[model samples]
Target: MYKIITDGSCDLSTERAQELDVLVVPFYVSTDGINHQKEIVELGIRDFYQFMIDNPKVFPKTSMPSIQDYLDVFGPLAKDGIDIICICITTKFSGSYNSAMNAKNMLTDEFPDVKIEVIDATVNTVLQGMLVEEAVAYKQMGATFEETVAYINKIKISGRIFFTIGGMDYLVHGGRVGKLSGIAAGALGIKPLILLKEGEIFNNGLTRGRKKSKQKIVEQIINIS
Candidate 1:
């Protein structure tokens, strides 16, 4: 049987991961950027956002999983000879793809018979989760490992992730605010809507306030559709 896995960037909950029959390697999150906790697994969403709001001095930091993290999951499954398809967030946004690849390489010589493929999802958040679910469905339908990988690659071609930052602290700290790179993100009422297409982040346009942020994302989706 083909096994599907993804990183925390997929925005999937623990229950959702269980229901989908997919393994999720959670990203490390921290308020101090030193003491880290696994996303959802150790850190809850409500607490994370609350910390962000309560402590404006420091934004919550997100760290991707390491090669060993992937290996821990891969080693057990590969030993059993189950084929694996690891779907990771876009390489541009995160190093999850590289980490997964490194883990696969380490085991290549050891488990020559076990098939292990790492996919660059070219997307993030719910879109990334969607890719994992698609793979699970394909497996449930009896698709082979090769066919599932092909479907993932084919479907991600048209995937586009549109979003609006309710808060820009994350982007500012990430040092990839694009056109607004050097500007003060919190200054004024400038709410920026962004897009993720083809593994790159883009500053689509500016909205007015917090309420308009979600509306802007929806508008972009409607326009695209």
Candidate 2:
């Protein structure tokens, strides 16, 4: 049998993950630099958002899962001779793909008969989750793993998502934007419409307010459609 694994950035609910028989590895996020919590395991999405709402001055930073994290999940499955397909968030946001690969290598020496394919989704959030869902669907349909991999890779290149942040300070903290640009945008109450292209993030343009930013996102989607 084939096993499907994904990281928490996919944003799949625990219920949905259980329903699909998929395993989710979590990333670490810290509100206070010293203490880290697993993204979905220790901190629920709403709770994380609430923390942001409650503490505007704090900038949350994320760290990718470690090699041990992957081994904790992958080892048991490999021992049972299950082929694994691990989907990770884009390398642009985290190095989870690399960690998974590292784990696969160590597992290989012990379980050389089993196969493991670690994938980079080239996206994050629900967009990344969509690819995971697609992989599950392919597995259910009895498609070869190679076919599923090829399809997701093609979609990754073509997929696009437009998003905007409530504050520019988050972008500056993440080193996604220059501090001066973030300050200038913050001063004018402007939000930058961001999107991923070729596995990299780009600020498409700027909008004056949150409402306008949402409108721009819709317009961009409609234009593309």
Candidate 3:
């Protein structure tokens, strides 16, 4: 049997992961100088979002999982003679992909009989979750490792994501947007449209209000459809 692995950034719930037999590697999130390992099995989505709402001044800092983290999960599975398909967030956003690659390379010599394929999912959150689900479906259908990877590559380019943040402070603090742009947008009650394209995040457009932003997102979806 093949095992599907993903990082916590996929926004998958513990129950869903269990149902699909997918393994999730935890990433680190720091809030107000305190570091917490974000494992969906331990932390619910509501609680995490509530913490973000409560700590407006302190933007949570997220760190990619280390190579050791990947090994901790891949080693035992490799030893068990189970193949693995690891889907990681976009390389542009995190080093998790590279870390997984490093782990795969190191384990190759020790576990030459096992096969591991690491994919740069080039997406995160719900979008990433959808990709993981698709991979799980392919696995369930008994597709070979090569077939699954090819299917993922074919569909990965077809997905597009658009989102609006509640506030710009976090974006500014993260250096995702210019400080002046954030300040100006806040003053004008404008919301910027952030899109994930090809593996990179871009601030492509702006809307005058939340309603307009939602409408713009809907229009884009309709157009894509």
The candidate scoring highest on lDDT is 2
Off by over 4 Å in 3: none
Flag clash pairs in model 2.
none
Residue pairs in clash, model 3: none
Q: What is the C-alpha local distance difference test score of candidate 3?
A: 0.87
Per-residue accuracy of model 2 over 26-141 as CA lDDT, tens digit each: 99999899999998899987788899999989888889999999999999999999989998998877899999999999999999999899988888888889899998998899
Structural similarity to truth (TM-score) of each candidate: 0.89, 0.94, 0.95
lDDT score of residue 171 within candidate 1? 67
Q: All models: lDDT?
A: 0.87, 0.89, 0.87
TM accuracy, model 2? 0.94
Give lDDT tens digits, candidate 3, residues 12-63: 8888889988999988776656757565545676677788888777677777
Better of 2 and 3 by lDDT: 2
For model 1, the superposed segments whose C-alpha errors exceed 4 Å read 177-187, 211-213
Residue clash pairs of candidate 1: none
After the best TM-score superposition of candidate 3, give how far the Cα of residue 111 lies from its true spot, in angstroms: 0.9
